[model samples]
Target: MQTIRSINLQKNLGDVLRTADVETVLVTNRDQPRAVVMSAEEFIRLKTAAGEPVPNEVRKSSPTLHRRIADPLGYDTRDPGYVEQTASDALDGQHADEIAREIDKAMRRWRLR
Candidate 1:
């Protein structure tokens, strides 16, 4: 973001508008930020985003909406929570732990042979 004092903004309105299209611009009055200038695309994007409600978990995890911003992993939208719920229900947490221990014991016994 670039900071432009109110005096500079008025004096260089064309230059300031050009800069704002490339990136966000902060307008300040007496060294205090008073307003922001962003491109039309950015303004529309922010307006659309403001209309939607985000999940609490997602909000807490990423205040800047950084979730899935980098190296995003694709998910199958065709199958919703039901598929995941069914798969998770297939194995209880306790039973999975017990099975893991049993496998470790068997692997150790085999290694001793």
Candidate 2:
């Protein structure tokens, strides 16, 4: 593996990227490794070989929120009410009045009931 200081990374990023096939380049700051530089294809291949899910470009081409919604015992909805429920849960951590004001503004803009 090749090691380069953070300063060298800024100066010779192109050269390091070009030599990615020979070794994975490690970027260091304060003599401690901070990041790695490798070809995207190599990184994806390594991740897939390690049994991690590789993001599908076909799925990206045709995106849907249905893929993300959690199905607890197969009980989930495509309804706007379900979205509002999730939004409300997310906003629970914040000030209720502020969240309500923001929701009201969004509803007005979208002409939502």
Candidate 3:
């Protein structure tokens, strides 16, 4: 990626467009990035990967997902005496045989295959 000031972008539009075809070019205004220039193929690929849901809509619909997105580390380490726990209780030193028995019981209870 390359950063170009707004004035420089205007002066070197042709070269910037050519560069953007190969990689991303960030356009900056007043030293802050204002826009991105990339190939149409790259733009489409990124949009497809991102999916259709807007961030605010997703945040409003699911609080748990919103928290996960806001804190990718699962929990805030900045909290006093914060203890990071594993994602699942089943992984807490359970033997394979015990886990298999629990899974079998759950499957039978739930009528799941």
Best by TM-score: 2
Point to the candidate with the largest lDDT: 2
In candidate 1, what are the lDDT values of residues 39-111, reduced to their tens digit? 6556655655799543443223221223444212222322233347545644545345555665787789799
Residue range 1-113, candidate 2, lDDT tens digits: 88999988878988898878567899999999999887655766676689987566512322233548444322234222346665676667635565677689779989994
Off by over 4 Å in 1: 52-113
- TM-score for each of the candidates: 0.44, 0.46, 0.44
Model 2, C-alpha of 102: deviation from truth (Å): 61
TM-score of 3: 0.44
* Candidate 3, 40-109: lDDT as tens digits: 5566557557895334422232212443454333343322122324223335653456557658977998
User: Which has the higher lDDT value, candidate number 2 or candidate number 3?
Assistant: 2
Q: Candidates ranked by lDDT, best first?
A: 2, 3, 1
C-alpha lDDT score of every prediction, in listed order: 0.63, 0.66, 0.64
Please list the residue runs of candidate 2 whose C-alpha ends up more than 4 Å from where it truly belongs after superposition: 56-113
